[model samples]
Structures are given as C-alpha cells and as structure tokens.
Target: MGVIKVLTGNYSASEGAALCRPDLIAAYPITPQSSVVEYLAGKVHNGVLDSNLVQVESEHSAMSVVEGAAYAGGRVFTATSAQGLALMYEPYFRMATLRLPMVMAIATREMTSPETIWSGQQDAMSVRDAGWIQMFCDDNQEITDMVIQAYKIAEDEGVLIPVNVCYDGFYSSHLTTGVDLPLQEEVDAFLPPVHFNHATLDPDHPISLDPMTPGNLLMKYRRSHLEAMKRVPEVVDRIDKEFGDKFGRYYGGMISEYRIEDAEIVIITVGGMTGAGMDAVDAARENGIKAGLVKLRFTRPFPAARVAKALEGKKAFAVIDRSVCFGWSCGPMYMETKASLADAADQYCHFSAIGGLGGADISTDMIYSTIQKLEDNKETKTELETQWYITE
Candidate 1:
C-alpha cells in the first residue's frame, strides 16, 4: 500500500530517490533543483535516510564525487538544473561512457546568455547526445514514478547506462500535486540489490579506467555503447509493465499516444505542456477536427519507430518544441521527428512550432491553433518552415 500526499515535483523526486535507498548522493544547489537535494539532506539529517549526503563546492565537484562513488560499486543519485548541469558536463559524459549505472534528476531550465533562470528544456536537450538515457515527465506524479523506474532501466544487465529524469524547471518542479508514495518495503521488493558486474575500483582487483585508446579500439567501444543503447527501449518497456503491476500505475513506455486512433491531424509535444496538448486535441475533436497528440517521454532513444507508427495514417502532423535547434532553424524534437519520418516524407504534411522559452506559458489555445494549422494544411505533402509561436 501507498500513502497519498500533496507534494511538489522536486519533493516527489526527493522522496522517490530516498525510497530507492541509494548508498550515496552528491549534488550542488541550483535554482528549482536545489530543493530536491535540500529535502534529501534533511532526510539524512533527521535519520529518515541512511545515505551519505556529500555537499560539494561546485556542480563539477559534485559529479566527480558521484563518479568515484559509483566506480566503487555503490548505487548513487544526484540532482541539478540549468547552469549546474552545464558545469558538470565533463564528468557527466564520463559517467555514461564508463557505463556506470546511476540516476540523476534534472529540473530542466533554459541556458544562459539572455541570463534568466526560469523553465525550459534547453538544458537537458543540450546534452541529448552525451550517452545518457533521458526521460521527461509531464507532472509531479510521473516525476516520482519515473525516478523509481529510472534506476531499474539504468541498472539493467544489458543497459548499464546513466539515466536523467527530467521535468520542466518551474512548471513541474514547483507545481504541487497529490502523489501516491509507495511503501519502502514494496520498493525494496520491486528493486533488487544492485549488483555491479562491471569494472570497479576495488583494492583487491585493480583496473585502469578510461585509458587512451587507438582509433580502432575506440570504434569498438563506441559500437558496444550503441549496442547497449539499442537494448534500452526493451528494458524501459519491461520495467514500466513491472512497476505498474506492483505499484498500480504505468505510463505508456517511451511515448504515450492520446486520442490518435481516428485522427487525421496530430500534434506532438513533450514535458509539462503535454497535458495542455491533450486538452487541445479534445477541443479540436469537439469542433469536428480529428486531432490527436503524442507525448514523447524518452528523448535520447527518440522513439522513431513508435512515432512513425503513431502518425502513420495521419494527414498532417506538427511537433511543438520548447527549445530551438540552433543551426537547424527549428526545434530539436521537430528536426528529430522529421528525420524519423524521412521514409514517409512524401506521404503527409509536417510543421515545426517552437515556443515557451524561458518559462513562457504554453496555453491550450496555442495548441488548438497549432492543430488548426495542421488541419488547414492537411492535404499538402511538403514540410513547412518553422513557426515561432510566441514572437517577442
């Protein structure tokens, strides 16, 4: 059994991490995500959690500490947002390539240089290629559940990769909602003790880590990493089913499809804005437009096959992105989705709409308008130029 309680997304993530009973937690404080580590520290101070809480001087040091701890065969956790994540990029990349199984909570925020600390997915999207399994949650409950499932997915024997459970910074991180807190005993039963069969820094059996490799050997390592990544989708689906069976809740694995059955026009979205997109689809349906939505939960593996399947028969589709793709002149998700549907490019119309940067609100009406755009261009068989939703 589990208890229902109102909790902010940050607190929910902290609670979920605590429930997993990690051996160690290393993190530096940053906006939005600072409260997560703060809550965990309180738990450590109050004796609710027995894990060692390392308060490092900087985000870089924090990641370094966790890499060493994980290398020593301990299950570890960490949290950060925005600039903190940027600072930790060095160790962050190493954590994945070394194939260390760990979980991190990222309260996604916009990058600097207009110098703001609101909410955006740019921080996490910026690191999509860093070899970590990235997942986005639409709400606090999903945030809590995903944190627990993330450990299982990351520690799978076939996929020993780091996982980043990301949610919109202020949107999800600060929003309060009721969450079902699962029992510690239940969690323990669901997640077995982590067994590290890979290399470790044990004194008895010494090993060199991340040594310089020749081009051919490096290619082999890269190929091995890709093989492991290919195994992630299966592991993710299995864990989602297993977690649902035990905890009574499940998010559709990888990507979630909503109202797409007979839809002729669809809008794809990610993160907290998904709920609004679903509502927009419903409104569009009421107005006699066969509109639907696809919420992308996992971005690293980029559910290309699933996405293509969901939009297969649709007349037109649009991807709404909160972060831009810089040189691509559109959003990252838009470009990726287009690439995923490359084989079907001549079959239907496609468009990219970008907005919600720096914590801007993505209202239901905006989504409805996007669906209308798709509907208007339903018969066209060409990709449109990127549309900026909230032109300043």
Candidate 2:
C-alpha cells in the first residue's frame, strides 16, 4: 500500500511530517533530534516539500516560531530533545494552554546532571502535565505512524491541544529499520488539511487571543482544557479505527495488550522497552509461567482507565519505566499506574521496576528477571521493593 524504505527514526519522523503537508517547519538541531529537522530542510531545499523552513538559534525560538505559525491557522511542526526541551519550556507550556493544534517530535534523551548525551525519557516525563498530548513510541515504525496520527488528533475541534510524538534518542532515533512510508496522496486522503482555526491573527478579522485574564476567567479556561483532555482517548480510538480502515495498521488506542486473556501475571511497559517486555513475556510463558504484557501507548492523558481495565483479572503486574520519579523512589509511569489502581490496590500484587536510563540497554534477560520476580510473588497481594535493572 506504501513505499517501504529503511529509515532511521528521525528520518521516519521527518517523512511523516512531510506527508501531512505542514505549512511551516521550525526546529533547531540537537543530538538525535537534529536529523529530523535536517531531513525536512533537505526536502524543502530540494523542492520536494513546499513548506517554510526556519533556521532557529535555539529550541525556544524554534517552538516560539511554530506556535506563532499555528496561531495564524497554519498546520506546523518542530522537534527537539532533552536540554533543548528544557530551554523551550516556557513557550512549550503556552503552546498547549493556548490550545494550538500542531505536532512536535521529541527524540527523548536523559537530562544531564551526571553529564551525558544519551537516550532516556526523563525529559518527556518531567513535563508530563504541561498540557500537551504526549505518546511514546516503541519502535521506528510506530514513531513514523504516530507522527501522522498526531496532527489528526491535535486538530480535532473537541481536543485542540498540541501533541508530542516521543521516541528514544540513539536507540530508536539512530536505529535504522524498514518503514512503509505512506504516499503523499494516501496521507492527504487520510489527514485532511487544516480547515478549523483556533485563532487567526489578521488585520481584516480582529479577535482577542490569549490576553491576560482575571483568576475567575482563567479558571474557566483551565476547566475547559481539562474537559478537552478527557475526550482524547475516545478521539484516538475513533481515529485509530479510521486509520486502520484506510491503511492496514491498527495500534490499540491508549493501551495495547498481549497474551493477557488467561494470564496470571502482566508486565506493564512504555516506549522502547515494550519490545523487550513482550519478549520476556513470551519467555516466561514458555517456562510455564502465565505472563502477559500491556504497553502504555499514550502517557500524557495517563490512560488510567485502559491500564486499570487491562490488569483487571491479573494476579500481579510490574511497571517498567525508563525514567525515574524523584521522591517516589520509582519510575513515573509506575507511580501513576499505582495511583490509577488506588481503589483496588489490595486486589493484585504489583511493584515498580526502573531501568534503561542514559542509553543503557534494557535486555530481554533483565526484563525476564522482573517477570520471574512477579511470578514468585503473585500470591503475595502486596507491593514489593522497587527493582532496578543494571549491568553491575
């Protein structure tokens, strides 16, 4: 149905953005995120893509430029990672609160203090509540696919928040794999042009946009934003169905389950760790252990309902997070999953497992070990000590 090519995750991101026919692409080069804008710049220079390309000095200006474009009723895109994301935090927060419809790609990287330029999701997790729709990718193909889907999800009139399609830096970013790039025509048919305008700043049509407001009015806007976020899961489900019907791929909306029907134990995963998690589940099944897997596809809205439902009958579950949550002594996703099941906390045995920080490999062996731990304590019906996967 589409042309297949071996593309690095960054290129896949660029390819997906190009297919959407954005009006503008603004980004500054940074680590693994560099190639995303580079590829788009090349297409623009070669006249392959008819989009305005802005060469910015920093990630802040990059996001600021895209936000301006979106405010003008233009479908826009940008990409950044780690420190760059931190640099753009100001405008980034405003973009979502403004309810601008656009997509940004985050080549997820570890924040530095120990000083490292490597793959990790600490950057993305740090700003989870920044009001943007954030979803992490498990592989290169999902990275590409979600990029296109992001725009459709963002621009929906009911849910006009921006989206961050995040994938691990160095791991999925530099990792090249075969991707079926949808033809421009196919994408055009699937993703309609930007027809709805949030607020278009024009001299002819004057309209107030994001003026400083009193606390009472601001609270109303916040409530409206929260209500809109509650609609994202259902919007994603309807869109995934439409996407699957048009193309042959169906990624389960917020959470994807594997081998969970009759399993007694489940391994919860997010982002790039899902592949190894599934492998560990298979290995555990072969060893006569009933282990299944549930991949948390979208983390921004948190998908608490889908996650709680997935582990409904399971005896035990362990959430493996690539980024750690401070003060909690566990990963952020693991903390959130536990919060989601607060009412039924006594029903299942669960614990937190943190690993794969700063580009460390999350091997199948390490994941299988976690599954074994769950199997050993499936009958305990209480949370266990947090497990940290490390080579040493």
Candidate 3:
C-alpha cells in the first residue's frame, strides 16, 4: 500500500526524491529550487534516504557531481533555476548528448536582462535545444507528479535522455499547496533501480563517455540523441498512464487538451498560466463561445503531431506564451503551434499573446479578455490577424 501525506512544494520534492530513492542528490542553493534540496538535505541527514547529498559550491559543480554519479550507475537527482541553469550549461548539454538519463527539476525564472529576479519560462526556453526532454507544470500538483514521472521517461531504454521538470519559480516551487504525497512502496513498485548495461567506469566493463571522435562517428552520436528524443512521446504516454494508475491523476501526455473537442477556437499555453487559461475557457463557454484550452506540458521533443491532431479541424486558435521568440514576431509556443497547424483545412488562424514574464501575474480576467479579443479578431476578418497581449 502507498503511504499518504499532505505536502508543500518543498516537501513534495523531498517525497519525490524519497519515492525515486536516488543514490545521489547534488545541488547548490538557489532561490525557489533551494527548498527542494534543503528538504532532501534533512532526509539525508535523518538517514531516511541512504544517499549522498553533496553540497556543491556552484551549479556547474552540482551538475558535474550528478553526471559523475550517474556515470557510475547511480540514480542522480538535482534542482536549479534561471542563473543556476545558465551556470550548468556545459555539462548539462553533455549529459543530454551522452544520454545520461538524469532527472533534474528547474524552478523556472526570468533570465537576466532588465535585471529583476522573478518567475518565467525564459530560462527553460533558453535551453530548448540542449537535447533534454522538458516538462512544464501548471500547478504544484503537476510539479511534484511530473518530477516522478520524468525519471521513468528518462530512464526508459528507448529514451535514455535527461529530463528537466520545470515549474514557475515562486508560483509552484515556493507557493503553499495541498499535494497528495504517494507512498514509497508504490513508487518503488513503479520505478525500478537504475540498472545500466554499459555505464561509465564499471570495473566489469570499462567504456568511454563523450570521447573526442572524427566527423563520421560524431554524426552517428548526434543521430543517436535525435533518435532518443523521438522516442519520448511513446515513453511519456506509457509512463503517464502507469503513473495515473498508481496516483489517480493523468496529464494525457506531453500536450494536454482541455475542452477542445467540438470547439471552434482553442487557446494554447504552457506552464502555470494554463490554470488561468482553462478558467478563461470556462468563462468563454458561459458566454456561448466555443473556445477551448490546450496546455503544453512538455516543450522540448515538442508534440507537433499531437498539437496538429488536437487542433486539426478548429476554426481558429491563439497561443498564449510566457516567453518571447523575439525577431520571429511571436513566442516559442506560438511559432510551434502555427507550424503544427499550417496544413489544416480551416485556414488555421493564430493570435499571439505574450504575458506573465518575470513573475508578472496572469489573472483569469486577462485570459478571458484575450479570448474575447480573439473572438473580435476572428469576426473582423482583418487583413493582418496577429495580436500581442501587452500593457500600456
């Protein structure tokens, strides 16, 4: 039987780590994500989790420690955000290309520019091509759940890629919430030990990792990474279903569709803004407008086919992005959604609304108003039809 407990974001993470039972927990203290490591530190100290909690001096060292741990056939876990993520860039990319299968949580925060520290998806977006499977969360519940499911997907034989389970820094990571913590027995049943047939530095069989090679071998190594990424959708779906069977909640897969069936227009969003976007969809329904919501839980190894299938016959759609693509005249989510719907029959309408960057509040009212804007724009039949949600 699975144990039950009420948890906050910090406790949720600690419980998640407990569930996975990693061999190493290496992390550096950064705001938001720091609580996760702190809670785990206590667990390590209390002897509840028999793991090495390495207090690395920097995020770079933190990732390096985990990579070394993972290479030694140890299940490794770590957490970070914004600048911390930027700091770990070098090893982070290598972890993906080498298919290390380490699971890390990123409390999403704004990257430096105007110089205010806050929550946003920019940090996650900045590393979209780092070859990791990225999962975004709409709330604390999803944050905890995704972290657990991420490990399963990452370690799957078909998809041996590292995963970043991301949530809004203050919104999900620091906020108080009622999370149902699962029992270790059930989690243990769900996730097996980190067994590697060919791990780095094993005495029985020694091998090389990230070794310098000529162009021919280098191309094959990169192709292997791409193949691993392509296997993510199936792995994610299977893991989510198994997790749902044990945990009683499901995110469908990488992309979750909300009320899109039989709807005329759909709003696409990723991250914490999804909850508000769904509420706005309900409001639009009350007004007899068939507007739906599609929240993308996973960004990298993007579900373009799923996105297209979800919005295949919809009359129009809007993408609500928290991070800008810049120079593309839209956000990353918007561009991806547009590309997905390019071959649709209904002439696939798209509106881009940017909001909630740098910890900015994205209220339900803002989302409701944006759907209203889409309704008006759809009716206007204007020559130019893209609009950005902004404040004067």
Q: Model 3, 217-291: lDDT tens per residue?
A: 989989988988888898889988999988898888979998989888888888888888889999999999899
Q: What lDDT is reached at residue 41 by model 2?
A: 96
The best-first sequence of candidates by TM-score reads 2, 1, 3
lDDT pick, better of 1 and 3 = 1
Cα lDDT, model 3, residue 337:
77
lDDT of 2 by residue, 1-392 (tens): 98999999999999999999999999998997999999999999999999999989999999999998888889999999999999999999999999998999999999997898998999999999999999999888888889999999999999999999999899899989999888888899999899764458776887887888999999998999999999999999999899889888999999899999999999999888898888889999999999999999999898999988988988999999989999999999999998999879788888999888988988999999999999999999998999999876
RMSD values, in order shown: 1.1, 1.0, 2.0
TM-score of every model versus the real structure: 0.98, 0.98, 0.95
Give the Cα error of residue 170 in candidate 2, in Å: 0.9
Order of candidate numbers by lDDT, starting with the best:
2, 1, 3
How do the residues 254-364 of candidate 1 rate in per-residue lDDT, one tens digit apiece?
Answer: 999999999998899989999999999989999999999999999988898899999998899999998989999999998999899887867888889988889898889
After superposing candidate 3, which stretches have Cα over 4 Å from the reference? Answer: 1-4, 203-208, 343-346, 379-389
User: Which residue pairs of candidate 2 clash?
Assistant: none
